[model samples]
Target: SGAPGSRVLITTRNVNVSRTSGVSEANMYQLSCLSDEDSWSLFKQRAFSGKSSDDYPELVPIGWKIVRKCKGLPLAVKTMASLLFCEFNKDKWEDILRSELWELTEGKDKILPSLKLSYHHLPSHIKPCFAYCAIFGKGHVFDKDRLVEMWMAQDSITTTARQCKEDVGRRYFEDLLQRSFFQKSRYFDSFVMHDLIHDLAMFICSGDCCEVVDGKLSSTSRVRHLLCRNERDFRRLLSCGCTDDLLKSSRTCYCVGDSMEPDDVDGAFFMKAMEGMFMKMKYLRVLHFLCIPEITELPDSLGNLKHLRYLHIYASGLTTLPESVGNLLNLQTLRVETPELNGLPRRLKDLVHLRHLCITGDFLGLTDSMGNLHNLRTLEVQSDKLNDLPESL
Candidate 1:
C-alpha cells in the first residue's frame, strides 16, 4: 500500500462549523450548558471546596442568588464564584447579584469578562459576521444556509476560483460556530445564540448596521439592515414613505414575526408596492418576507437586484418563479415554501452562483438545466407528487 489513513480533531465555538469541517453529527460531541444544580455544584467545588459548609452558612443564600444570575453559564458562574476566594462576604456577593455588568453596554460586560475576551479574539473577518446576526430578533431560530447567504450578500465572504462566495461564506459561519458564538436549537433544525452572546451582538451593532423597527424608521441612512416585529409595525413603516429611503441604502430588509394567515385583502397592494419599491433597491442583498404567508409572486423587477444573494419568502402563494429570476446571477440561497407551487422555470440554470435551494410544492419534475448548477451544494425539495429524478441531476 502506498497511502495511509489519518485522523484529525478540531475544537470550535460553534457546532455547525465543526460539521462543516466534515465531522458527521453522529461523531460530533456537544458540551451542554450546566443545569442550575450542576452549575452551583461546579461553583461550590471551585469556590468552597476547601471550606466546610457549616463554616460559612451565612453567605450560602447570597451565593446561591449570585449563582442563579449566571443562568447556568459555566464561565459566568465560574467567574462570579471565583470572587468568593478573594472576598467571601455577604455584601460582596450581593454586589455581584446587583452588578451593572448584567446590563450590556456597547459589547462590554463585567459579568463574563472571559466570554467577552473570546468575542474579542475572533478574527476580523468573523467579527462583523457575528455582529450582523443581531439583525435576527432575540430567541429567533435561523438556519446555517440563510446566515451564510446573507454574509455573502453583505460581501463579508471572499471567493476564489476553486470556491464560490457561498462556500466561503459557509467557512465564515463555521468559524463562528466552532468558537461557541452559535448553538444548536433544541426545537428546530436551526441554531440559536446564547442570550448573553446575543446581547453582545446587539450591543455591537447598536445604531450601526442593524435596526429593529417599532413604529417609526430611524432617520439615519446608515441603517443597512432592518427588522420588523409585526404586520402593524411593517405597514406603519411603509406608509411613511420610508421604504424608498430605506431600500436605497439598505442591504438587508426583513420581517421577523409570528406567523399569520396570508393578508389576501392587502396582499396585492403590498406586493405591488414592494415590486415598485424593490426595483429601486439596486444594492439590496437580502429581501425576506419573514412569516407573511400570502405573497403569491415575486415582482418582475426582482431581476434588477444584481447583488441579491439571499431571498426568503415563507408561505409563498405562487406556483412558479418568473423567468426574470434567472437574472439574479449572484443569488446564493432561495427558500420559498409555497404549497401551490407546481414548477420552477428552466432559467433557474442562469443563477450560476446558486448554492442552496429549498422549495416545497407538488413538482412536475426538475429541469435538465438543474445539472448545470455545478456550484449547488444543498437541494431540499418537499413534494408528495414528485416521483422521478431528473437524469441531468
Candidate 2:
C-alpha cells in the first residue's frame, strides 16, 4: 500500500479483494477473450492451417459452431481448437454437432466452465453484463460501445455498468474478454462467444427460461431469441401451442445455419434449395444464405417480402434471375454471383431503391439491364471478357 510504483498482478477469484486493493488508485486492465472472428480464426488456424484442397471451403462453415462455443476466449479457443486440428473434416464438424459436443466443448475446463466460473464469480454489481449475454448465445459477436448502448437501453447500466459509463462498459467487456469470458478478434474491434458459453449463459437464465418440452412451446417476454438447436426439441414448439405468439415476439429465429448436405453448398442448384427455406421465413429481415452453388430461377415468394431490405445469395452458380425481384420495393441490397451465367434480371430495371447489387459468378444472360438502378452505389460485374461491359456505361 505504501509503494506507489509497485505494479502488482493479483489473481484472486474474490471481486472484493481486487476491488478493495485498487478501487481508486491502481489502473485496471480487464482481460477479455480473443474477438469472435479471431477466436474462430485461431480455432481454424490450426484446424485448417496446413491443410489444402477444396475441402477447406466446406470445413469453414461447420467450424462456426465450435467457434461459437468458445465464446471468444483465447484459453478456450486454444484448448478446444487443439482438438480440432487432429480431426479436420466435415464429418468431424458433424460429429461435434452430435451428442459428444459436451465432451469436446467442456473437456478442457479452460474452455467452458472454467472460463465462465471466473465470470460468474464477479461482484453482484457486474453480474448483469454476464447474465444479459444469454439472449445472444455464445459465439455471437457485438461491438463494444454498441453493447454498452444496449445495456443502457435495457437499463442494466444503473444496476451494473456504472463506473465510467462508456469506459466502464468497455472495461467490463474488456475485463470479461481478458478473463477469457468474452473473446476479442485479432483486429481488436469486435468480440465473440463460444457456443458452449452460450449454453452456460442459458443455464444462468434458468430462472427466466421455461422447460420447453417436445411438441410444446414456451412463452417468454423479456427474451427475444430462442436457441434450441438439436436437443430433440423439434416438435417442442407445437406442444406449447403458442408458436404464433412466439413468432411475433421474436424478431429473429435461430436454426441450424449449415445445411446437412455439403454438396449443396458447391453444386450448381444450391440457390433453389435455399429459396425453399426463405419462402417459409416471412419474419426474417436479414438473411445470410452464403455459399450456395447455383440458381437457374428465383422463387416467386421473394416478391411477397415487401419488408426485405437485404437479400444475400452470394457465391452461387447463377445464370438468369426472377422478374419478381423488382417487386421488392424495400429491397436495398441484392447480391448474386453467377460469373458464367451472363444476364441480369430484367425486373431490376425498376428497383430504384437498391443501393448495392453484386454479381460474382457467370451471368450469361445480362447485357445492359442494370442501368435502371439509379440509386446503386456498389455493383459486381458478371460477364465474359467484353470490349464494352454495360452498354449504358
Candidate 3:
C-alpha cells in the first residue's frame, strides 16, 4: 500500500516479525526504557502538574521510590503518575512504595503487572465497582454524574455516616480516578478507562458480574450487568428469541454505542421485543434505552421492579411515565427526554429515596407534595406551559 514516498512505520513487541518484514538492522529503531531521572521527571509532570518542588518536600522521596519500580517504562511511569495525581497524602504514597505488586514480574511485560498492583490494592467495596466497568466498550466516555448514579443503582457504593449515598458514590469515583483506573476524556466531566485497565476489569469480572451480548446471546443466569453494543446487535439477538432463564437476574441492561436510526428496522417489532425483554428482567436496577425514538411508552409492569434505582429514557417518544412508576420507592436517579410529556404523577413524592431527577417536557407545575421528596439532590425540569413555582421549591 506504500506509495513511492510513503513510509510505513510499524511498532510491535516481536523483533523477528520486523526482520521478516524486511526491516534491516539499519532501519530498526529500538526504544530503550527511561533512566531514573527521566522517569521521575515524567511522573512528576503528570502527578503534580501545577505544583512546585517546594510544595510537597516530604513526598519527593516516596515518589522516587514508586518511580524506581516503574523500571524506566514511560507507560508504567505515566500510569502510576496519573494514579497519584492530586494525591498528596504521605501514607498513601508510602503504601504504594511498600506494595508487593512491584515484585510480580521482572522484565518487558512489567507494565501490566505493575498496573495490576494498583488494582489489587483497591478497597473491598470498590473492587466490584471497578469490575462492573467491563460493561462499557473500549474508549467509551462516560458522564461522571450519571456514572455515579448508575453505580448507586447497582448498589456498588456504600453510604457512610458522614456522606449520603450519592456523595459516597462520588468518593468512590474519586478514589478510582486517583488510582489511574479512569482517564479524562476530551469532553468536560467525561472519562474513559484505559484499554489495559479495561482488560484488567474484564479479566476479573468475566462470567461473574458483567457480560456483553455481542454476536450471540449466551446463557446469562449469573450475569447481573449486561451490555449490548448497539441497537442493531440487540435486534439481531431478539430475532433469535431469548429464553426465560436468560438475563433473569440481570441488574443492569445497558444499550450502549449507536442507536437505531428511524429507517434501520421495523419500529413496532423492535418495541415489542424490547417490552418482552424488560418484562423478563424483573430484577433490573439500571436500565438505559439510548435514543430509541420508536419507544413511545414504557411497560406498566415497570412498577413491579421495586429494586429499580436508575432509569434513562434518552429517546424522544412517550409523553409521561406510567403512574405505577411511583411504586418504585427505591428509585434514586430518573432521566427522561420526552418532549411531549405533560405531567408527573402526584405520587412522585413517594419516591422518598430519589436523589436525581432530570426531565425535559411540557409539564404544567410541580405539586405541593414535591416538598415530601426530602432526599432529592438534583432536579431539572423544562417546560414552556408551566406558570407557578411551588413555594416548597
User: All models: lDDT?
Assistant: 0.73, 0.55, 0.79
lDDT of 3 by residue, 1-393 (tens): 677898888987689989999999899999999999999999898788678756899999899988888889777788788777888988988888888777676445323766787677778999988888887877788887898888888878887678777778788888888777887999977899877788778767756544346656543546767677887776765666656665577788777667777788776886677667767877889988664676766667778778899988766767667778899999999888788787887788899998898988888888998888898889988889888879886
Candidate 1 whole-model C-alpha lDDT, 0 to 1: 0.73
The TM-score obtained by model 1 is: 0.68
Clash number for every model? Answer: 10, 53, 1
User: How far is 59's C-alpha from truth in model 3 (Å)?
Assistant: 8.4
Worst 10 residues of 1 by lDDT: 105-114
TM-score of 3: 0.79
Over the stretch 61-159, how does candidate 1's per-residue lDDT look in tens digits? 777776776777786776555545535667766665665555543333422654554565567878889888978877888988778778877878766
Listed in order, each prediction's TM-score against the native is 0.68, 0.41, 0.79
**Candidate numbers, best TM-score first, in rank order:** 3, 1, 2
- For lDDT, the strongest prediction is 3
List ranges where model 2 is wrong by over 4 Å: 1-137, 140-259, 262-280, 290-295, 314-318, 337-342, 364-369, 382-388, 391-393
Candidate order (lDDT) = 3, 1, 2
Q: Candidate 2: minimum summed lDDT over ten consecutive residues — where?
A: 230-239
Query: Lowest-scoring 10 consecutive residues by lDDT in candidate 3?
Result: 210-219
